[model samples]
Target: MNDWLLAPTLQGRTLRLESLSEVHAARLLRHLDEETTRYLSRGAPADLSVESVAGYLRALNAVPNRVNWAVVTNDGDVAGRISYSEVRPADRWVEIGTMLTTPFRGTTVNPEAKLLLLERAFEVLGANRVHFKVDSRNERSLRAMAKLGAVREGTLRRYQVRPDGFARDSVMFSILAEEWPAVREGLRERVDAALR
Candidate 1:
């Protein structure tokens, strides 16, 4: 068991990813607007309280399956969340996911945040392939994944259930260890253009 897998911070200049703690649930709840919940596999409660979200984070923390982070913006507000889950330590593979808040919905934060995670996964964690799965209906996410140079391998039919109780198809994407440099460069340029 790696005790430090739960480290509390992963920061970039425009964004920061910190371990989701009780202190963050209140502000994190603020990011869970309707539009933000639409494509996500999980949804915020109708009137989610800080303590409840804290408990959720605690439960996730207890499980060895994944690590969740509160996506904090440059201004220090909780903007959303990103996680590295379904890790295969023996194979050095992992999946990346996030629930960006509504305000960050149409911004550069999403791509930039992902760039950070991808970097950590491949360069730091020495992963072989980093995977991303999006709902087939989420065109925006698909486009963003394309922008990051993820190759669409295929779709997972009826892969998971949606928040609305219907079966949702998942579009799978991946970036191999060999493709990181070019992908990273492309994302850096995209972020630069978006800021201008």
Candidate 2:
């Protein structure tokens, strides 16, 4: 099994994915709010204090199975975060998730981040499948996943309970290794167009 504990920094044309660090905590705190955390059942904690965010970053860094990264723009500003979890080396699969600041929501930050992450997962990590499980209520997220060329697998009913005690359905999507070549080309085109 690959040790995702040691995360590698992933660089792209307009953004970089660095290992989650305390330095990013303050910037991350600025983006954590009810609206940002709504669809995420295990989203950032309610406390937005710098200290709390730092502590959370520390804890995330300590985890051995999950790998997290802070998304930074080319100009050196933190934009958001992305992570690979539920990594199973034997199965060669991982789940990708993100929490982006409002400013980056409709921008290319997310698509670029996912492009880099998926490249690493499929090309470097030898992952056979890269998947996502999004809250069914989040239509935006569902559409975004589709835009990435991931096929919707199915929906898991009552898959999770939110912080607000609401039962949430999870919509699953994935891109298999066999399907990666076309997906990669599509993503590369989108990213190239965005960069232009």
Candidate 3:
């Protein structure tokens, strides 16, 4: 088994990324309710009851190679969830994703989380690649990836079906080892700007 597949907790300021737990059930419910599932590939419902959300979180936590983390704000609010999944140690790759609440959107939270994850994946975990797959129609995510210097590799047609029963194309983006130095610098600059 690839070591990168090991689900691990990564922490950051304005966020505490711990492995997904049953304790996050309520927070997860709050998050899924704040966003529409139409643009989310993970298919989280917009209105999940506490029990239902707990069940969902438990199920997801049971999955291997998936480290789900609750994104806690500086105010100690559970703002959203993010994860590094499908870790392929042999290929030195991982996928980072999240369903951030509107309050956290377009904020430094997303990029800072990604930066921390990348630092761990590449510097600590010896990863060579980090991939981000987004719904082609999600302009926000695409724009964010572009800002981070992730190159658009290509599109996967009809990659999956959304909750609305429509086919969704996936836009694949990645930052490889050779490109990490520059990308890292670029991301650092962006995060620093947000701090200023």
Candidate 4:
């Protein structure tokens, strides 16, 4: 949809969610490390070049229903990336995906990013449901999602194959429109507390 193609820049006290573009490739790649991507289906490339990442970002521009954002900290550093994918407008369902560099892991970047996206999904876009699928082995990520109040649905066994050949399970979590208010307030409180 056009909304995915032109996702307006979202701002928060701690970060800015800007459309992922070629120019952000270098900044995003600068902080990426093997440990940070260990949970992904394809591990960090042995050679993670700016050109490659840039090409990927550019290519994503044409993907119809996915919108990717560069998670930029207030000081103008690209801290990570987040996106809304698997968008099904007719069904009012969407999925959120994210990867944050270690430097910003413990900060408000994650929560604030969620607040913005969830707000847009439920409030602005009239989504009936928003979900996230995370590698089950990623305890930190699982905990983070649970902490945000997304109800755990179940695990998809052998959902993805890691680069090293491990069949990874994926944990599904979701928040329905009816559940949005509480989740939004929790995220707002977490993010707002940090802003103070």
Candidate 5:
């Protein structure tokens, strides 16, 4: 666990965000469907197992300057996971990422979960910026970032190597501290509309 930051349980109208643990492994493992795994760096998750996922979640605790959360729905089902990494306390910034199941993709969970995370980063943690990096081919994630009102700061070509040894581009997006109010309100409106 990092001294500067610890994962906090964040609540929203439609869902809850709690620090991820092995207890969530089975449900999170089930979220590893083809549609949801394709865009991820691991790509299709060939050898994924509950134990492997549990270990993965376990290892996350030792990662410096990063925090992970399991998104739980009102129904008590595990929706997926969201995390912010590349956290620089001195710089007061973080890069957020998500891996939600296909079922929750277009629902209130995404925005409200993001609302909670962004709220923590900006309002609670005193971060000046929160950024995202989406695989260029992942249109769904790209759209999510745009919908969140983050500015697209261009792409980094061939930024990461995929599990299959293929290179992929990453689209950069960020929200500055000055822009949080508008983005937070937009997310709230979307979340509220989805809840209704």
Candidate 6:
């Protein structure tokens, strides 16, 4: 998929994913707490200065193959960021990752956002698969992925080295195009229940 074309806003009932921009840096900074950054390979930024955040935003925009979005509430508050990366058009697959703000966690925000992103990946982008890789030590993430109907593929030992210089194993999970119908229905149900 063309990078420009793939950047369209994906909207849901309570949230929207808009193309990531420098303007979002400030709002994003407020949410990247120690808890949020603990599992991120890059870890937390040593400095949360405006300039640093802007630089990070610029770097995100420069990536050619991936599209990052600022996850914002319907009322326009930025809640976090998510992206489709490791995009392989020929293979018709992509990997999704990133962190959400604490307030949005365990809420409908994540399920609905994933619903929107997965729909765009399978329906709009014609992806055959969408995958996620979480640090193997992260039980919460592992459970969350399972709840979403993603099949646990296996673990990759020493798959990534964190900024702290520690090698981390990654737990892989995926949902194939053929499984999208069932996965989508389940996610919709979860979102509905969450809203209620």
lDDT of 4 by residue, 13-117 (tens): 889999888899888888888777778654554557998778766766666778888999989899988888668888888899888998888789999999999
- lDDT minimum window of 10 residues, candidate 4: 39-48
The digit string of per-residue lDDT tens for model 1 on 37-155 reads 67876544444677777775676556576878788888878888788856776778888888887788767788788888888888877889999999999988898788779999999
In candidate 2, which residue ranges exceed 4 Å CA deviation? 62-64
- Local distance difference test, each candidate: 0.79, 0.83, 0.76, 0.85, 0.85, 0.84
lDDT (tens digit, per residue) of candidate 2 on 114-164: 889888889988888999999998988988988888999999999988767
List per-candidate RMSD values in Å: 2.3, 1.7, 2.1, 2.0, 2.0, 1.6
Better of 2 and 4 by lDDT: 4
Higher-TM-score candidate of 1 and 4: 4
lDDT of 6 by residue, 42-159 (tens): 5555677767877876776677777889999988888888888568888889888867878789988888889998998898888899999999988888999999999999999999
Candidate 3: pairs in clash: none
lDDT of 4: 0.85
Question: Candidate 1: lDDT of 161?
Answer: 80
The candidate with the higher lDDT, 1 or 3, is: 1
Model 5 scores what on Cα lDDT?
Answer: 0.85
TM-score of each: 0.88, 0.92, 0.88, 0.90, 0.92, 0.93
**Stretch of 10 with least lDDT, candidate 6:** 1-10
lDDT for residue 163 in candidate 3, whole number 0-100: 62
